[model samples]
Target: MKDILFVNSRFLSQEITGVQRFSIELSRSLKRILGEKVQFIAPKNIIHSHIAKELNIIEFGIFTGHLWEQIDLPIFLRKHNSPMLLNLGNTAPIFYKNKTSTLHDVAYEKFPDTFNWKFKTFYKFAIPHILKSSIHIFTVSKFSKKEIEELYKIDSNKINIVYNAINEIFKPIKIKNNQRYILGVSSLNNQKNFHSMIDAFNQIADKNIKLYLVGGINRNFASTKLLDEIDKNQNIILKGRVDDKELVELYSNATCFVYPSLYEGFGIPPLEAQACGCPVICSNAASLPEVCSDSVVYFDPYNVQDIKDKIELVLYNEELQNELRRKGFENIKRFSWEKSANKIIEIIEGLK
Candidate 1:
């Protein structure tokens, strides 16, 4: 009999954002550690067939998306004697008491303007109940843990911090590129502070140094007024929704990677850039300072001039860039999928 059931509903319905990436990588590590003791379950409509096949996911339920998660998933678990459920994505079956959930951040609560009304309303109604019902909660950083505790009035001891690590594909590449460009990766949204980053990039004195923005727009988020500006600027390139290999190449070749996000559970892109031997210029906001530590050059996300200054500081200095790359390599050693997986196993065992 399976000891744990992984709610993989995110794989079926949602695209791979930071939240889904957390679930996917953690599940992979858990599967390696737990073997047949754990089983991954998802709805019948699987968007990530490659992932489903690798995980050997069992498809069930007539309903898809949240309907499948709320209705069919609980019913299915009930038939199986209600094994311990693991929900890595933000949401879970609200009524399932035997579950452990990973809530990445309280962005929806803190920055409600970033999301649509329906999305905000649903999470506000559902998340507290889910946290209360959960056996334990897992979040990505200390910043998030404190936020969750304060916002939901949950005990600090009940939450676990599982830091995100770069996938093997993100490692430093030996290839050389003559072209120079600054890189930014994340979904296009107000929370990302892309408007400020764009403005900052525009003010950069070097006309030849381009800025490449990688990622697609998330519809659930309220759109930022960046498209018209992007169209007007020739130096700013938007490479939307790249695959892992392409992302690694972009990171490896970038003169520097700039992340101007106002808030994060634990920023992953900076780590990915670091793993590819790229220097990082990051906003010292929210959980980013905790995740990045001293590895990245810090800037105020709200200040366009500060963002540009930091970018240029790293971009122009080869010695400083190399030092950051060295520190980044060292910083990355503190996190790994396997290590996080082992921690989860320990927690599960303690419960038993």
Candidate 2:
């Protein structure tokens, strides 16, 4: 009998973001460790067919999207005698009691204006219930674990930290490129602080170096002046949503990768850059310092001048860039999908 049933509602309908990426990678790792003991399930409407096939996910339920998650999924679990459910995504079926769910961060609670009213309203209602009902809670970082406890009054012992790691595809590649460019990757949202990064990039004295931002804007997020700002600068190139192969290539060739986000549960891009032998210049905010350690050149995300200075600090100095690349390579060894998955397995086994 399958001991754990993975709720893959996020895989069916949602676009791949950091949260979904965590779910996908963690689920893959869990499957490898658990073998036939875990069963993965998803809704009928699927957006990621490649991922769906690779995981050998079982599709069920008449409803799609949130309806499938809330209504159809719970009913299916009940039919199976309510086996222990593992929800790697931020959400889980509210009514289900025998489940462990991951809450990536309290970004919605901390930065309310970053998300739309509808998204905010649903999270406000759902999160509390998910926290209350789940048998256990999982988060991506120590910072996020603290936020969830303080914000929701959750017990410290109930939450588990499962760090994210870069996939093997994001390793160092010997790609030849002549053009000089800096890289930034993440959704163009208010909390990501892309506007500040762009403003900082504009201040750089070198006109030859270009800034390439790779990510698409989510409509559910509150609209920003990013598009208008991007139009004013010719040196800034926005490469909307790229494949993993292309992203690895971009990271492999970048002068340095910059991540200027205001907050993160556990930032993955900087580590991905590290895995690709690219130096990192990152924001010294949220969980970045904890995840990045001494692997990156830190700058205040809110300060455009600091961002510019740090970018130039790594970009111009070949020695500092090489040092950061070396540190990054060492730092990435602290996290791995298999390691995190084994922790989760131990926790589940302990509960039994």
TM-score of 2: 0.97
**Tens digits of per-residue lDDT for model 1 on 1-352?**
2366455455546788898888889888887877877889998888889888878898888998788889999988999998888888999999988888889999998888888888899999999999999999999999999999999999999999988987888887756777799999998888888999999999889999988999987654635458878878989898989999889999998999999999999989999999999999999999998988999999999989899889889888999999999999999998899999888878866765
State each model's C-alpha RMSD to the native. Answer: 1.6, 1.5
Best by lDDT: 2
Clashing pairs in 2: none
lDDT (Cα) of model 1 = 0.88
For every model shown, what is its TM-score relative to the native structure? 0.96, 0.97
Provide the overall lDDT of each model, using Cα atoms, as 2-decimal numbers: 0.88, 0.88
Write down the worst ten-residue block by lDDT for model 2: 1-10
177-285 per-residue lDDT for model 2 (tens digits)? 8889999999888889998999999889999999999997665562546787787788888898999999999999999999999999998999999999999999999
Q: Estimate the overall C-alpha local distance difference test score of candidate 2.
A: 0.88
Candidate 2, residue 34: how far the Cα is off, in Å: 1.2
